[model samples]
Target: MSKSSIYLPAGFRFAGVTCGIKASGKPDVSLIVSDRPLVAAGVYTTNQIVAAPVVLCRSRTPSSTVRAVVTNSGNANACTGSQGDADAKAMCAHVASLVGCDETDVLVMSTGVIGKLLPMEKVKSGIEHAVAELADREEAFFAAAEAIRTTDKDRKTESRELELGGESIRIAAMAKGAGMIAPNMATMLSVICTDASIEPKEANAMLRRVARVSYNRVSVDGHTSTNDTLLLLASGTGTPLQGDSLCLFEQELTELAIQLAKQLVEDGEGATHVMQIRVTGATNDASAETIAKTVAASPLVKTAITGGDPNWGRMVSAAGYAGEPIEPAKVSLRVCEELIYENGTPLKFDAASLSATMKEHPQVNLDLCVGGGNGEAVYWSSDLTTDYVRFNSEYTT
Candidate 1:
């Protein structure tokens, strides 16, 4: 797709601007506004110590329509007690006032360092500037993507278009996350907009289903953030999808979400390679997911991948502790097409060739088959490196 092809659905405008929040002086605030009330659905982090913004947005769930979303980076506005909640509400109210909508029609999201109060004055100025600059254009969309970044290496955005109900429908999304990205229901802040009309109930169901397999399946550092939020807004500017058209829309949403999820892993903090873990022949999908996630979150497995060491033992150990019943005698393992373990024994393989393959490929595939029950799942993750350690060690300083 061309650079200009990533357009937002009709009736939506975007803006991103710098507040004095980040020491780097980069854009730290973003705004997304619809020309009219748009149906909105969202999934948020399951973390117990939720951010103020997450709490606020969750309260607005099942809302028939929302007019705007205001987001900020460089300050998570989490764990600040009542003050954080006040700040979050202030953000929504500010955006609502600018957009001529009720505060309840505005959703708020925050990312970056946690346990700090928001710089309200700077945020106020930034929101004013962003609202003034809002426009329905690629540049504005790119700015919105850039403004949500914390440790991310670059802006992540995806777009899809298809003919549905004799109308050209478009879906576009932008996400920002590179660390603290494991999510129970969502990932680090993402906003998706589509022109196809869909009711709030259907949108909610579709968002949850798509998120389960996409954002919820990936892990960066195995630490879910307090501000993980994913919102889908429908402008209702095109024909409403029904029957097969709705199915097609769901498939396209899944594809776009998966694309964005992989982008987050590829840009994982200090990550050198992306590892895809697949578990098949399990008792059920839940079991498969547990095993895949276990292997994906294992530091030993991640570090081994970082060093190009095809250590199969770590993979087996991870699966064993995943709390799923496994027939050790029937288990099989492979890394990028090389079957190194099967029939209860580790097969002899050329370590040099495997290491060379790891060195040459930025993506490493690990598949584990435990007996034959037809259940399967896939999870994406990044290799843990010393650079990851170093970057995080000095992240707050």
Candidate 2:
């Protein structure tokens, strides 16, 4: 997206700068700031080995006082012991001082290499430069999005506008993720900004509910990151959405988040096709999601998608092994809208036609029914390609 096409939310400013943190000399540090006090909520990775930045930000959010987020790429600050913890806090402290806010009012996030110490001097300098350059412009917002990227092929941004309580509200978000993704929380580092008024408690609840159906439903490579986090800040410059208005705001938030999540899947490392796996007729939503994730995470299924092979056996067996209650005799499967399997019997369909359809489109949809029930779920996944393996094998070299 270009600067002219983007939306800059009211009361928010963004900045991104380079400070030698990345060997490629790209913009590696970014800041998202608000000119006024705002309600904030966050969702983070569920990995047991959490990153220092995630720990610090998790304790400071779901508040009404947060003002800024300082982030850096090229160093994840994960598994680096106590020094890593100290570095994370220092980053926040520096941003707080620069922005004239309390230490707790500044949140921090880091991505890139894991198990490495952050170059604090460079990070501190970058923070100073970013704070000084902060601007309320679409170019600045785009820069902030670019600065958080690691293996992503493109920067991701989305915006939504809604009319609530006779007031116009806007929600804009940016995210960075291309690998090490799973449905364990936010799945990546994302910053969401809005001008709608909301309470801290309500914002927290809404974030979780929105994340459940959006971020949590996306899986890329099935590996969860240590620094995955999604932070939402509401500037409350518009009318406070309540009653039906609050519900509408949440719906828009969900739609915006899903757009971002799909972008991440599309940008998955070396990805060629994105699979929209839908599971229906399960016992419950949770069970449906389990089956969907299993099918999406299957290496056999992903590779089949990469080769445009209409292989229904891999998908059926994946759902059967999801540990959920599944009756093979009652299962149905479709690949690229072609019913290839039904009720434990394989159908003789035009496999060449189905394969050609998969090859012609970047999005491949698979529908699976595990049993006769009402539960349903959808998951976004990327096809496993040789390029994906090659890129990951040389990621640290």
lDDT of each: 0.91, 0.91
Alpha-carbon RMSD, each predicted model? 1.2, 1.3
Per-residue lDDT of 198 in model 1: 92
Candidate 1, residues 128-158, lDDT tens digits: the string is 9999999999999999989999889999999
State TM-scores per candidate: 0.98, 0.98
The reply for model 2, stretches above 4 Å from the true place, is 1-4, 237-239
After TM-score superposition, what is the CA distance of residue 276 in candidate 2 from its true location, in Å? 0.5
Per-residue accuracy of model 2 over 198-252 as CA lDDT, tens digit each: 9899999999999999999998899998999999999985556789989988999
Q: Candidate 2 — what's its lDDT?
A: 0.91
Residue-pair clashes per candidate: 0, 0
* Residue 249 in candidate 1, Cα distance off native in Å: 0.4
